[model samples]
Target: MRTYLEVSGGGVMRKQPYVCGLDAAVDVIDGKWKVLIIWALNHRRCRFGELRRLVPGVSEKVLAQQLRELEADGIVHRESYDVVPPKVEYSLTELGDELNTALGPLGAWGKRRMAVLEEAGQD
Candidate 1:
């Protein structure tokens, strides 16, 4: 097993044992619904309904839970306004924008790989 160190202020804070090769940073965003939520919010700010439509097969309860977690992690911002019907919107924070930028290439790679797999299976 490999041990990884957490660095803070350019110094090693503590040593952590690697469990799955992925570090804690990846673990935080490893929730089942997190990536989906991030992908949905990538294009623009969306309301609850819009998000629901964008992410198919996610239950309302799960979506709400994921949003709360994302907001707590400082990756997403939830803004509520005082209005007749109570308008609420969700958008990615600067941190989230950075994460999304990193994920763009991964997403494209997955799409291309899937296409290759489908073509090969047709033979």
Candidate 2:
């Protein structure tokens, strides 16, 4: 018989085992747009237009949807100010900062891999 150890936050054991044995973290940030949005917000807070400009190739509707989802997940915060033009801004929450920290190494790995792919004419 094989025994599996389920390790979670702070090395604590979970009472209920995962269905597929995969972490739920990935599910929260799943999809191409979500990561891109998080990456853009990782640097600083941005207005709607600024975010749309920073992430190239994303449609307005899709971007809005991604932002809403991130906001609902508590990883991103959306603030609105009563102004002439209805000012709105988006920034990473505390959870998002932690997530960003974890993703930094992955981003670095991707950068290195991309450089290699470019040299090999794959990118």
Which candidate number maximizes TM-score? 2
lDDT of 2 by residue, 14-92 (tens): 3343355235577567778888889889859999999999999899999987887777767899999999979999999
lDDT of each: 0.80, 0.80
Q: Return the clash pairs for model 2, or none.
A: none
Model 1 Cα displacement at 7 (Å)? 20
How many residue pairs collide in each prediction? 0, 0
lDDT of 2 at 117: 100
Model 1 earns a TM-score of 0.77
Q: Model 2, which residues run further than 4 Å from truth?
A: 1-22
TM-score of every candidate relative to the true structure: 0.77, 0.79
Model 2 / residue 43 / CA error / Å: 4.3
